[model samples]
Target chain A: MTQSDLTILSNREIATSVYEMKLGGNTISIARPGQFIDLKLDGFFLRRPFSVCDLENDVLTIIYKVVGRGTEHMSSLTAGSVLDALIGLGNGYETSTSGASPLLIGGGAGVPPLFMLAKALVSQGKSVTAVLGFNTAEDVFYKGEFEGICSRVIITTADGSCGIRGLVTDALTEAGDYSYVYTCGPEQMLKAVWSKINTSGQFSFEERMGCGFGACMGCSCETLCGAKRICSDGPVLYKEEIKWPTPA
Target chain B: MADTRVTLCGITLDNPVIPASGTFGYGYEFAKLYDINCLGTFSFKGTTVLPRFGNPTPRIAETPSGMLNAVGLQNPGVDAVISYELPRLKEVFFKPVIANISGFSIDEYVQIAAVLDKEVQVGWIELNVSCPNVHGGGAAFGTTPDSAARVTGAVRRVTKKPLIVKLSPNVADIAGIAKSCECAGADAISLINTLLGMRIDIKKRSPLLANKTGGLSGRAIFPVALRMVYQVYEAVRIPIIGMGGVAGTEDVLEMMLAGATAVGIGSANLVDPFICRDIINSLPAEMDKYGISRLSDIIGGAH
Candidate 1:
């Protein structure tokens, strides 16, 4: 919510296409788990949105992928660089309402936000089972971070280059008794989870956005009730409210 | 007290800066970051009669000093908007919210305006007569003076609210279209929607966007936007909402001096969410420095 050009505390690559960056912005320091910051890299017209990985004091940690030009420039910056960011966006996950033994699913870029959710859940004396998905073994990230906070941490990769060869759903062992499920990933993966589990959950979708905030209706999702903007009402939506488009 | 007040088309704005349609969703998202009511007003994304899925993938591409978009007016039909977006917009923003309306036909424009006419929250209707990126439709209506007049006239009959006709920069005779909108009963004219542009993938040997063409907006389009605003201002008596590549308060001032009653922050909003606020905050000081008290006193005063 507050805009301050903070310096980079540290920027290091952890896995393929993934890097952990730390900034000194106070706005990001107070950012909740599910909230994201829109970052402006040099020479790009639009700011890129990144979720808060961790925060302490004036320092803000974010794990990001070098997917496009913006991130590519973000990757090249040194420790002294400054970033103009719109921090504290989207309503984060509500921890108090979540039931006991919540099932957490995160794929690739989606994994960063769940770290905070896991920390929040465990602090409240609740058991969390996290399933982290990546494309290949080398691409895996935050396995250690999730393991530190959760009772059970499962890892999945499509090529069998890592833990389970199939997908996050492959790691859904035991009965479908999870109190609530929270997931973020590519559309196909979300659809898979949407179909397999009839239980209630929360979903975060990625859409091409005009303004990372709600001004542009560029990133709108059709819900069961009606249409809602992902940037404003939610990048997170209750499972029941979503009307997943039938694949053409 | 902050001198955060501006008037356009005889309508008073709390401030002159606003997030352009398609950039600021429904005025709710930015409300989370800052008090949205602190500024002038907000314009919602384009609405149509039927829900449009928008253009295919690669709908947007960033070019040097600008960006291209082929969004294809993706919206949840006008009826759905009145039922869904309007109620939500009413809850979040207290200022006037301009509903941007687009259509494939003249009747569609009337139908959409009629639906909006019933909603008192809607402060104005911005007609997208010349969207260059759409296929076969928008540019056609915008390029011809007759077509622009007909569309504006049709919508004018359905609503008593202020009508602002958005112009396209692709046309050669922009003044003709501006005059046409004025004659067609338009209350005001918003100029320079986007210029028709294309990009090539040197490595892939194909066009960059799936639509093969897109509307270009950003810093590169400013001069063109200013010139068109000047011409249109001279051609018509209606107020002009100038937009192209406004990034700062200085740009806003320049746009106003060139005859823009208000300015639209397009690509600049994408780069910095605080740009609009920066312009709004610095306007009074800028006026003081220039020895001017009222923004209207300097309208087209640069010449």
Candidate 2:
């Protein structure tokens, strides 16, 4: 990973408590769609990890929710504010492994990484289907953005305020069959998608991380192939190897 | 023109800047970023007899100028480390690497030590007596002088390699514990491990980390680590590898003067992946500013 002072080009709230931030920096290291960037916020001891939502030459975009003190601090910053960030962290999704038809599913904050993944899959000439999930209509974002790139877009809300009523899994019956599935969201949502999906796919898992890189084993998870670090071996894991934790 | 080499437990390191365990993985990971051979040597991840999955999610909590982690010594079992991790490490890192071993029981510690002692690349075995995340073993042996010495003595018997007992800072008398390990035949000592600390999420009215508490390390703990290293230096004659929030060249110099024969860079690695390399690269110029010619000459100079 490379550390650089990235200038914030824009910081604006797109949805309820959700924000879209654009940063200007050397975007050379951000080589993959599912890769993330870790920001060194002032006064905080650890750097905060955010997935790359979109990347253009010298520009990076990320979406974050105001969940904690760090993101809250991030929302307070304006354009031209500089952030010390470690770019191109974690193993991103392997697009080369995608089949002829691929499905992308995202839930809440997890939708950011899928945006980039959808773009990459579409650019490869593969038929891509995007499924976006949120709790309510006000919480939904990037619907128009996904419509521009993906072949089909399915939006799901639990409150029935928008699109289909119920969770992402509730809308999957109408999403048609796919050769591969890629998804990221909360554990419950991921488990539901993993159980309902028909084909082998890649699932990106999130854990509270220390160093967004492999150095810290703080985000380690147990899998069929021994213990793997979520930051390195994944944020993305294939369907075959994932072993879900027994519910408490 | 300055000599950066400092010998730890009879093994001479190219420099005194060794990346601390848990922060540097098995060396191969960082070796991909920069030439890790520039480092004195790095202590690999804390190893145990049985493979560990570590603590639950939200294992990390941020503090001012520091972070607390309850990673609870997550490592593939010693067998996998020796068979898989070390072989890959050997290809990238040519120098003798320090092996950091942690266990839940005395026998487990001895068993792990005995296995690693036979590895040719392991220059020193850093016996972690103060891992705060685990339940029964780790810090329990470190908080008291008696148990610290007992674990030290048991492991010291099976390993012919230099045995360095890592001390925890979350103790009543850190120096006493250091002296106890020294008296129990520890070849050297390394301190201070992360301090026990916690943080609360006010809105949720719950602990930030699922583990509830973790060991604090980074720039915030440097002064506390320096004081403990100084106190331990006065109490024992064995060589000391000082670490606890050591980030830059200045911190490295200060740690050596406070009685560190060598230094370990911990939390700083999380902040910057290339920090150890940066510190090593900047040491000579910084050393020149302080009018020091030989890096080893400053060890315990403050005393």
Candidate 3:
């Protein structure tokens, strides 16, 4: 990972509490789709890790939800602001694992990384289906962006305020057969998807991390393979290796 | 150029900037980012007799100028560390690495120490009595003089390498515990480990971390660390390795002046991966600015 000062090209609200930020700098380190960047925000001790939404030469795009103080501060940043970021953290998705037909599902903020994944899958001559899940129609984002990249895009809102009602699982059932499934969302949603999906896929986990790299073992999760660091060994873990603990 | 070398228990380090345990994982991970051999040496992750899965999720919380972590000594155990991690560490870091070992019981501590003492790569055994994340043995032994000495004496019997007892700052009389460890035959002392601290989520009306509490470290705890280091230095004749909130060259010099033979860079590593390197590189320049010629000359200089 390379740490560089990235100038904010734009930080604009796209959905209710969600924002789309475009950063300009050396994007060479961000070599893969699912890799993330840790941003050192003003007045915060720990850097916030955000997944790469899209990349274009020298520019990097990330979508963040204003959940806590860090993202709240990020939402207020103007175009000219510079952010010190450790770029290209965590092992990105292994796109070679994707077969002829791949199903990509994302929930809320988890949708950002899948956007890049969908683009990569489509570019490789793979037929990709994108499913975006949100709490409501008002909270939805990137439907048009997903449509521009993937062959088909499905939007799911819990309150039946959007395309398919219920959840991403509901949309997954309607999306039909696929050779591979790649998903990222809340743990509960990811586990639900893991139980329902039959194909081998990769799941990106979100954990409270100390260092967004492997240095700090703060974000370790026990998998079938062993105790793996969620920040480095993953933000992405293969479905087979995941050992979800019995709910406490 | 100013002499940055300092000897800890007769072992001379190239510099005094040792990255604290849990921040620099096995040295190879950071070696992937930059050359780690430039460091005096780094303390490897806290290891135990058995592999640990650590605590549940949301194990970290960001405070004002620090962060609270409840990582719970997540490691692949001592055996794996010796068989796998250390061999990998040897590839990137040629310098002797400090082994930070933690356990829930005295026997467990002794067992881990006995095994690590035989390893030629281990320059020092940092017996961690200060870890606050675990329930039974960690900070419990550190808070009291008797228990601290008990663990220190037990591990000291088996280990031939320099035994540095890592002290917790959560105790009421930290000096008393340091003196006890020194009496129990500890070769040196390293203080202060992260302070026990907590934060609550206002909206959720619950603790921010899943573990409810965690050890706090970073810039917020520097003064507290310096005071404890100073106090411990007075209490014991053993050389002290000062840490907690050591971010830059200035903090390093100040820690040395506070009676640290060497200063450990902890939470700062998480902030910038190259922090230890940056601090080491800037030391000579910083010393020139402060009219100091040798770093070793400043140890307990404030006294």
Candidate 4:
């Protein structure tokens, strides 16, 4: 909630419509892998929430897509501009839940956070396997980083332009024998993963959010118990707790 | 060790930071991220006598320096809230919870308030007579002083708890509406729910939001909200909960100086869930930085 004029450490296109920016804010130094920061972009009222892509020292890395007005304005920001950001938000993933043999799955922009999760697991002497998904080779991101940390890294694209042709689930199917799974992606792909995997897994769900913390119930999903706010209770939820929206 | 406490309508809150209605969702979800009780108070989603599906999706659209939403007061209705939501709320929150009630008619307001008044956990009742986003319902009741007064007077007859009337900013004379609510027995008034706006997708060649027009909120609306609050504060004898596009403690101080007894943070909470908590923690230290003591002492003192 602290406000700071963060200098752009690096803002560059990592994939088609996807970008990575390194911001100099002290808040970034304390950010965990799964937590996010809301960047107040030029000509936008609500700050855009981006997951902490990577953090080192005072540099906070955020990878985002130019999906709306906020990100569109963010894309036009140059190298030296100072932006106001609300950093260190939401509950990041807990490593204790990642078993000795764990599989990580990420799709599109979702692949960024898994890179940090892989690094954390490798440091703990855990065997890590990752499946990174993209729609095409140009859309693919974070291949080298995952390769550096995980024992095996599988890449999948919808078009036959990259690693394994087809979806991320196809890539995951190729690499088996995982004790636990951690995934983040579009709801449909997550539902596919949920259906195929019998093992306990952690998932991150995206919703049209207002007040990304617990304040607005705008981003709510029904569960067996009742409704839960996705931003606070989770952008991350245990697989069993999630009640998917039935297809229209 | 700092003093961050304030009193709203004689009800003591640990701080003046309340998560506005439609934002805090009864306080359970935020409780998972941090202690819910740490907040001054939290207002629940607007509850009506009957269930509501809300407006159509593509319900939200991003605007320059703000966003537009047509989330037409979606709730599981008042009875479901009392039966289902309240028990869950009691488990997660210990702080004061204000029930924000909305209705299409006068009797609906009374029925909902009467139900909430019996619940000891409900510290106050906030009448939502001023949401501009909904059709045939919201902005209609709020745009006219007579209708707003009628609704308030009807609810006042049934409820004993302190009542806060949330005013719509779309009205031409907000001061008249404030007077109407006060005359109708509203204990306090919260002004400037989202202003109405619309957007069209250039490529799709159609309105971006399904509702066509929606309520505008965020930093862009701050000035408009402040001006309305100042006008309404001058006209109303009761307390004012000023809200529009409050992003920080500085904005909070500005609203208070404009004569708001307390302020509400709406869309800013979406950007950062920890904002209320951050503002709460930073207030005293921020006040100290300005050589101020009590939050009340700082209110309306800005010249």
Candidate 5:
């Protein structure tokens, strides 16, 4: 991992409380698509961890939602503001395992990392389809961005204010013959996807972290192999080894 | 350049900066970021007789200039630590490490401490007497002088290496506890383990940490730590490893003046991985600024 000061190229509201920030810095250490970045914000003791949405040249794209005071401060940052960030954190998605046809699923803030995953698979000559879910149309984001790269894009909202009119699972039945599933989102949504999906897939999980490295074991999650730290071992895990059985 | 070296329990350290246990991992985590040999030494993760998966999720909560952790001492058990972790640590760190062990019984403490004493890399044994002694009605051993001295004497019999009784600040009488441990043959003392604390999520209408409570550490506890170190310095003759919210070099000097032979950086290491290394690097300049030629000369200077 590399610690570098990233200058904000742009930080703007994309949808409702959601924001897309472009940071300029050395992106060579970003090993894979699903890996994340931990940002050290001013006035905060713990550094904030966010998923990497896109990376091109020296510019790093991250999408975040204003969940608390930390994000609230990030939203007000102007151009030329620099952030100290621990870049290329956690194990990202392993795209080589994605078959010829892969379906990407995301819910709310979870949509950001899949956008990068979709781009990675598309570039690998794989046919990519994305299922983007939100609470409502106002919370929806990156629908068009996914549409630009994926062969097809499906949007779902819980309130029926958007495309599929249900949770992400509602649209999965007709999402075509996708060979694999790669998803990121809230735990409740991930549980739904874990049960609904039939194919072998990968799921990216989030946890409140300390250190955002291997030291603290603060972000550890139960797995078939053992208790693995989400920050370093993964924000991404294969569907089989994930020990969190579907909800009762 | 200022002299940063200090002698602790007959062993000389490069500086009085040892990364506290749990925050530094096995030391290799920071070794990948920078050379860890720059540290005086570090206390490895808290080990137990059995592997503890630790507390449930949301184990971390951010407070003002500090954080809370109820990680339940999630370690791979003592046997695994001896075989797996120590081997991994050997490749990255060159200095002898402080083996921090916790227990629910005196026998348990003796079992682990005796085992660690045989390991060539263990220079000191830090007995974390904060854990509830299951046999003692679940009250932490460090909370009372009797239990604290009991555990210290039990482990002291097995380990010939320097024994540092790490005290919990949750007690009503910390200085009394320190004096008891010293009487029981503790070679040194480390004070101010995280103060017991918790936070609530108003939206969820429940606790923020899954365990409901956690130990508070970081910049928020510096003053309290220094005070305890100062008090313990007055109560005992053993060396003091004072830590709690120590974020910079000035704080290190202050801790030494408060009678700490060493200062440990806990949660601050989580904020910036290179904090201990950076502190060690800047210590000389900070010492020069303070007009102190020797850090050893400052131990309990305030007293």
Candidate 6:
């Protein structure tokens, strides 16, 4: 990963409590689709980690929610704000392994990373299907964007104010005949996705991290191969290697 | 020209900046960022006899000027360190690395220390008597002078290499603990291994860290660590590896004046992976600005 000062080209709220920020910096470090960036905010002690939404030339796009003080402060920023960022962090998605038809599933904040993956799959001439879930119609974002690239785009809202009235699984039957599944979302949603899909896939996981690199061991995840670090070992993991925690 | 050389336990380090244990991992991550040979030496992750998965998710929390982590000594165990980590560290780091060992009992410490002492890559065996994050193990021996001394003496018997007992600051008398380790044959004392602290997620109305509490480190702990280093300096005859929130070169120089023969950069490495390299590159200039020519002369200068 490379560290560079990125200039915030735009910071605007895209959906309810969610934002889409475009930063201008060196895209040289970003190699894969699912890799993230850890940003050092001005007054925060720990860096805020975000998945890369899109990378066009030198301008990088990221989506964040104002869940806490850090992202709230991030939402207040304007153009020309310089942020010290650790670019191209975490082991991102392995797109080459994506087969003929890829099923990209995402929920809420998890939707952003799939945008880049969708773009990648489309460029590879693979027909892509995107299943996105949100709390409501207002919480929905990038639906049109995903529709523009994928052969089919499915939207699910918990409140039924949007597309299908349920979780992304409620709309899964319509997704129909996909070769691979790539998903990122809340743990419960991810767990559901893990059990519902029969196809081989990759999953993106999140944990409270210490050093967004591999040093601190704060973001350890248990897998079939013992425990691994989520920051360096992965924010993404193969579906076969996943070992979900037994329910209490 | 500013001189940044210092001798710790008869071994000469090019500089006094050592990345604190648990912060630098096995020198693998930072090696990808910049050349790690420039660092004096970094203390690797806290290794135990058997592998530990550590605390659960949300193992960390952010506070003002600092962060709290309950990593609970998560490591690949001693065997993996010898077989995998040390070999990889050897490839990138040319200097001898410090092995920071943690254990639940005296035998565990003795076992791990004995094995590491045989490795040529290990320069010193840093006994982590004070890892506040783990339960019934890590910080247990460090909270008391007798326990700290007992662990130090046990490890000292196993390894002829210089022994540095890392002391926790959560006790009543940090100096007493340092002196006890010194009297027990410890070659040096690394003070202030994170004060136990915790945070609450108001939104969830529960503790932020999975372990409930964690060791606090960063700018917030600097003054407390400095005071403890200054206190421990007057109590122990051995050298002091002063740490706890040492970020910049000024902090390094300040730690030296507080009686640290060598300084450690911990959470700062998490903030900026290249901080140690940058500090070493700018040490001479920062020293020049302070009218100091040789860093060795400034050891306990404030005293």
What is the C-alpha lDDT profile of model 1 across B50-163, one tens digit per residue?
Answer: 988776655667778888888788778888888888888778788778889988889988999999988988889999988776676666788889999999999999999999
Enumerate the candidates' DockQ scores in order: 0.31, 0.76, 0.87, 0.31, 0.88, 0.88
Which is the leading candidate under DockQ?
A: 5
Worst 10 contiguous positions by lDDT, candidate 6 chain A? A239-248
Residues A1-248 of candidate 3: C-alpha lDDT, one tens digit per residue:
89999999999999999999999998788888999999999899999999999998788999999998789989999999999999999998999999999999999989999988988898999999988899999999999989987889999999999999899998777899899999999999999999999899999999988899988888888899888889899999999999998978
Single-chain TM-score of chain A, each candidate? 0.94, 0.98, 0.99, 0.94, 0.98, 0.98
| Positional deviation of residue B228's Cα in model 4 after best superposition, in angstroms | 4.2
lDDT of 6 by residue, B1-303 (tens): 788999999999999999999899899778888999999998999999999998877888999999999888889899999999988888898998899999999999999999999999999999998988777888899989899889999898999999999999999999988998999999999988999999998888999887899999999999999999999999988999999988898999999999999999999999888899999999999999989899999999999
The DockQ-derived docking category for candidate 1 is acceptable
DockQ versus reference, model 5: 0.88
Q: Write the per-residue lDDT of candidate 6 for residues A7-36, one digit (tens) a residue.
A: 999998889999999999787999989999
Between candidates 4 and 5, which one is better according to lDDT?
5
Residue pairs clashing, model 2: none
Which one is best on TM-score?
Answer: 6
Tell me the TM-score of each prediction against the true structure.
0.85, 0.96, 0.98, 0.77, 0.98, 0.99
Window of ten residues with lowest summed lDDT in model 4 chain B: B52-61
Give the runs in model 5 whose Cα sits over 4 Å from its true position.
A245-248, B131-139
> B57-104, model 3: which lDDT tens digit per residue?
789889999999999988899989989998988888898999999999
Assess the local accuracy of residue A210 in candidate 2 as a C-alpha lDDT between 0 and 100.
Answer: 85
- Please state the CAPRI-style docking class of candidate 4: acceptable
Q: Model 4: per-residue lDDT, tens digit, B201-236?
A: 989999987678888888899999999888887787
A127-190 per-residue lDDT for model 4 (tens digits): 9999888999998877887888799999998997999999988876688899898998888899
What ranges in model 1 sit over 4 Å off? A1-4, A28-32, A56-58, A96-98, A173-180, B1-7, B12-18, B25-44, B49-61, B74-99, B112-124, B133-138, B157-162, B198-213, B291-294
- State each model's TM-score restricted to chain B: 0.97, 0.99, 0.99, 0.97, 0.97, 0.99
Residue A226 of model 2 has an lDDT of 81
Question: What's the distance in Å from true for residue B42, model 2?
Answer: 1.5
